[model samples]
Target: MNYSKLLFLFLICVLQSCTSQTKINGVSFVAAGIPVTDKHVNPVVQVNANYATVMPFGFIKDLKHPEIIHNTDRQWFGESREGVKQYANSLEAKGIRIMIKPQIWVWRGEFTGYIKMETEDDWKKLEATYSSFILEYADLAQEINADIFCIGTELEQFVANRPEYWNALILEIKKIYKGKLTYAANWDEFKRTPFWSQLDYIGVDAYFPVSDSKTPTVEECLLGWEVHKPIIKEVSDKHKKPILFTEYGYRSVDYAGKEPWKSERSMNIVNLEAQNNTTKALFETFWKEDWFAGGFIWKWFIEHDTVGGENDSQFTPQNKPVEMIIKSHFEEQK
Candidate 1:
C-alpha cells in the first residue's frame, strides 16, 4: 500500500475508536397498577434498550420519621412483589437486563435527600426500618436474578450522616443478593457519597444543570457539560469505578436544562426541540467516554402510545421529537 493510503486508514481507525461507546441504553420503567405485558416490553425493545430499572417504592411520612412503610394497599400493583417478578421475567425473556431499584417516596413529594433524624433513638429506629425495607427488596432482586440491584435512591442525608450504617448495610446486602450493586445518589449528592468504593459502579441520578437558556441549543448545552464533566470524572477516577447515570433526562419544556431535576407539572409550554437538543448534548458528552458506563432515562410509562405527546412537556420522550433522537443513539450499537 502507498504511504498516503496507510496514513488515511490510520486516521479513520482512530476516529472510530474515539467515538465508540460501551453504553447501556436504558429506560426507567414507571410502575403501574396494571400488569406489565408484551405490549409494554415491545416499545422498550424497539428503542434498542438493553437495560430497564424497575422501581418499587417504600413511603415515609417525613424527613425525620423513622418508619418506612411498604407493601401496603396504597401501592401500585406493579410495585408489589408479584408485579416486579413478572416484569423482570417478561423483560429478561426478550433479552433485556433488569435493575431492581427500591426507592423511598416521602409523602407529599418531599425530597428524600433531606431525610435526617432529630435524635439518636430516632436514627436507630429509622436505620432498622430502612434496612428492613431495603433487605426485603434485596431478597426479591436475588430471586429475580436481576442484573443490578440499587440499594437506595437519592437519600443524601441518610448516607452522609451515617457512613457506618451504609457500610454495614452494603455488607448485609451483599450477603443476601449476589448481583452487581449500586446506590442512586442524587445528581448533586454523588460526590460526597462515602461508599462508592465498595460497590460495582458509582451510580448518580444525573440531573445536572446544563444550561439556563429558555430554549437551549445543543451546542450551548455541550458547553454547560464542559463544566460538570471534569468534576464528575474526578469522583470516578478517585474510586476507580465507572459512572452510571441511574436516572438522567430533560423535560420537553422551556428552561428544561436550567434545573433538570424539577418535575414541571404546572402549565408550561412544550418545546420538543429543547428536549431533543439537551438530550442530544448528554449523549454527545458522556456516551463515548470510557469512564462513563451508561445511564437510564428518567421515565417511560407503560401506556407507551398514549403517553407524552407534542402537547405535553414531561421528562418522557414518548411521541416527541426527542424520542427519535434517543432511538438513533440507542440503535447505534457500541
Candidate 2:
C-alpha cells in the first residue's frame, strides 16, 4: 500500500508548515533619502520579512581626522536620527523586528574598508569620533527598543587594526543599548576581526562570489555556496555565535553572480532570472542551518518606484521576480 511513502509525504507537509515562519526573516530597508510610506511598508510585510535593517550614514574626510562629517547636530546628514526613530517605530508597529545599522560614508575615499590610521593618536581620535556617532544611534535603539543594533558596518581595516578600541566601544554601546548587537563585516574581513566574542552575532555582508558564469543556474549558485558554507559554519562554531548575513543580494544584471559583492552599477542588463536564481540559491542553502541566524537581503526602497522593474537592473528586488522568491522563502518559515 506504499504506507512508507505516505508517511514520508505527510512528514514533508508537516515540516513545511512548521518552518513557515522565520526566526529572523529580514530585508534592508533603504531609508536614506526615502520616506517610509505605507506603500513601501506593505510590500515588505507582504514578503513576510519580519526583520528590517535601516542604515544611516556618517561621513569622514580622512582616516586621520578627528571629526566625523555629519551635518545634523545629533543626527546623520541625509537621514536624520529623528526620521530613523520614526521609521523604526512604524516598522515595529507593523510587527517587524528592527536593526539600526550605521554606516560610514567616506567623503573622498573609495570605501570604509580603506580607512586605516597609522598612528595610535590618529586611531584614538577616529575611535572617539566614531564612538560618538554609534552612541547616538545606540541611545535611539534603546529608546525605541530596536531588535538589533549594528555598531559599525564595513569599517574593515580600521576595526582590524584597533581591536582594543572596538572592544572598548562595544562595552560602551552595551551600557546604552540593551538589544542584541552586531558589526557588519565585509565577507573577506569577518575572520580578521578579533571582537566577535563581544557581540551577539557574527555579521557577514555575504557578497561572496557564487559563479563566474553570466547565466549560472540555481544549481551552479548552490555549488558556489557549498564551498563557502563550511568555512562560515566553522567560524560560527569557533565563536559560539550564530551568524547573520547582514547584507546579501544580487543585482538584476548578467553575471551578477560572478562578483555579488561589487556595489557598482554594471552594464544595463536586466536578467531577472539571474537574480531569482541567486535568491533561491542563497535562501535554500542557508535558511535551515542551525548556526545560520538568517539574513537581511541587500535592499528595499521607499522611493524610485519605477527603477527596479523587469527592464532595469539594480539590487533592490522590490518590483521584480526576485521579490516573489524572497516572499516564498520567508513564508516558508511561517
Candidate 3:
C-alpha cells in the first residue's frame, strides 16, 4: 500500500471509532461507572439523589393570613424559594444532578372538593395561577443552576385536555430557563399524555403496587422493577426518549387487615428492615438499566405544617436507613 493511502485509512478508522463511542443528546454511554462530560453521549447508568420537597411553594399563598388554613401566602414564596435554592446548591455541591420539581396541584383545602378546568374561563384562571408559580420557581432554579427542572407533577387530567396551553407555557419557560424540561406524569396515564414529544425527556411516577395482597416483602418490592422495566422500555422505544423515574415510593405504613393499620390519628411507621430491604432491592434492580436516565424518591417532606394522618409516615425518607444508602450510592457515582 502507498504510504499516503495507509495514513489516510488510519485517520478514517480513528474518526469512526470516536463517532461510535459518542452518544446523542446530553447523556453519555458508559460501561463502568464513569462520568462523561460530552453532552452528546447517553449515560449507560445513573442514579438520582432526589430530595422531593416542593410543598414549600404552596405555602406562598398563605403568607398574609397565617391563621387561614392551607392558604399558602406570597411571603412564603421567598422563604420557600430560598430553601429550594439552598437545597439545590447543597446537592450540586455534592456533584449531584438536581431535578427541581415545582408543584402545581390545586389546594384542596382552598378549592373545596374537586378542581377542574372545564371551561375557557376556568382554564384562564388556572393558567394565570399556575403560570405565575412556575415562572417564579423557574427563576429560582436558574438562580441555583439546577441541572433539570420539572415544570409540573401529576396534573394529568388538566394537561391532557389542554395541550396547547401547556405547550405555550413550556415555550415561555424555555425562554427564561435553559436547563432540561420534564413533567412528572401519573403512572396510569403517562403514555396517553399528548405532550411527550414537547419535552426534553420522559418522566414518570413508577409506583406500581408491590402486591395486591399485603405489602410484599423487601425481595418482592425489589422485583417490582421487573414488571416496570418492560413498561418503561416500551415507552422509551415508542417515543425514542430517555426515561426518568420522577416519583416512585413505597408507603411505610404497616397494615393490620387489608387496610393500613391506622392509629387513632397517625399512620404506623414502616418497618425499618422493610424500608432498608426495599431500598437495596431497588438499587440492585435499577442501578444498571441503560434506558433509565434516573429517578427521584417519592418525597422528603409533607406539605402541611403538622405531620398527621397518612402523611405522617407514608413516604417521607426522613431519618430512615435509606438515607445512608442514597449517600453511598451518590458517593460511588461521584
Q: Per model, how many backbone clashes are there? A: 0, 7, 18
Pairs of residues clashing in candidate 1: none
Q: For every model shown, what is its TM-score relative to the native structure?
A: 0.93, 0.89, 0.68
Tell me the deviation in Å of residue 267 in model 1.
Answer: 5.2
Ranking by TM-score: 1, 2, 3
Residue 19 error, candidate 2, Å: 12
Please give, for residues 209-271, the per-residue lDDT of candidate 1 as tens digits: 999999999999999999999999999999999999999999999999899899948837888
lDDT: the better of candidates 2 and 3 = 2
Candidate 2, 117-150: lDDT as tens digits? 7778887888778888899999989999998999
Please report, as a residue range, the 10-residue window in candidate 2 with the lowest summed lDDT. 69-78
Q: How does each model score on lDDT?
A: 0.91, 0.83, 0.55
Task: Give the least accurate 10-residue stretch of model 3, judged by summed lDDT.
Answer: 22-31
Error of 1 at 327 (Å): 0.8
